[model samples]
Target: MSKVMKGLLLVLAIALIAVPASANLVATSFGFPVIVQSGTTSAFNQDTAFASDFETLDIDFPVFGDGFELGATAGVVAADGVALTGTANVLPFGPVNLAFPSISQTVEQTQEVTHTDFAQTNEQAEFAYPFVGVGPVALPGFGFGW
Candidate 1:
């Protein structure tokens, strides 16, 4: 592995161990995509597998005002293929060796998440507003008169 990949892996490990449970989490994923097969014209027979590592940090906290909330999240993922070992059979060659190529990738991302809602209270009297004319008779109001 290169220096950058090693450093990233180290950082991910440390973040997973040091961060709090509510803030950070680390996950490992494995997949068996290829299955061994024995048939005509098939040269290699092996069980292929893929593995990846991921780290996530998420926070949901209060904002500057009521009914307004804010959130933020950051994550990193690294994927690479694992080693494959099995037997190989060919038509002409009979039994032969098999080795499959693999690749690796690392991704890091951050996002801002937030939610805000403007809601009215149950008190209908708070919106009541009425105006009176200069004369003794009161003018008809257009606001909530309840």
Candidate 2:
């Protein structure tokens, strides 16, 4: 994998671990889409819209929780494959951070990820051309404790 992809995966993994719920969490996103069209470019200019709904769920078992856990779910949808995603982690310092006062605080940090993608079918309705595209992600820096 590219260094950037590796870094992103690392950051995501850290985000899951940094949050506290008396346990640890591992998460992934599941995407599903629906498309509708008249097979004509003119239809879009006249007035048209398409819809898709997708959701991501976080599932985990805490090492200290005796392998039991609570799950977290987030979702989003858009017209023509555009989407925005956001997630928050609330952390309680508890005994661990309390011992080290400098790190003790109850705060919520939120991360947002946005992406837009699209593809097209040819006259033969063949899913070819790959319709090349690009997606971008703007993630905010970490939010500290209160």
TM-scores, in order shown?
Answer: 0.20, 0.16
> Candidate 1 regions off by >4 Å?
1-94, 122-146
Model 2, residue pairs in steric clash: none
TM-score of candidate 1 on Cα atoms, chains taken together: 0.20
Candidate 1 residue-pair clash tally: 0
Q: Write out the backbone clash pairs for model 1.
A: none
lDDT of 1 at 98: 29
Per candidate, the number of residue pairs that clash is 0, 0
Please give the distance, in angstroms, between residue 112's alpha carbon in candidate 2 and its true position after superposition. 1.2
Off by over 4 Å in 2: 1-103, 125-146
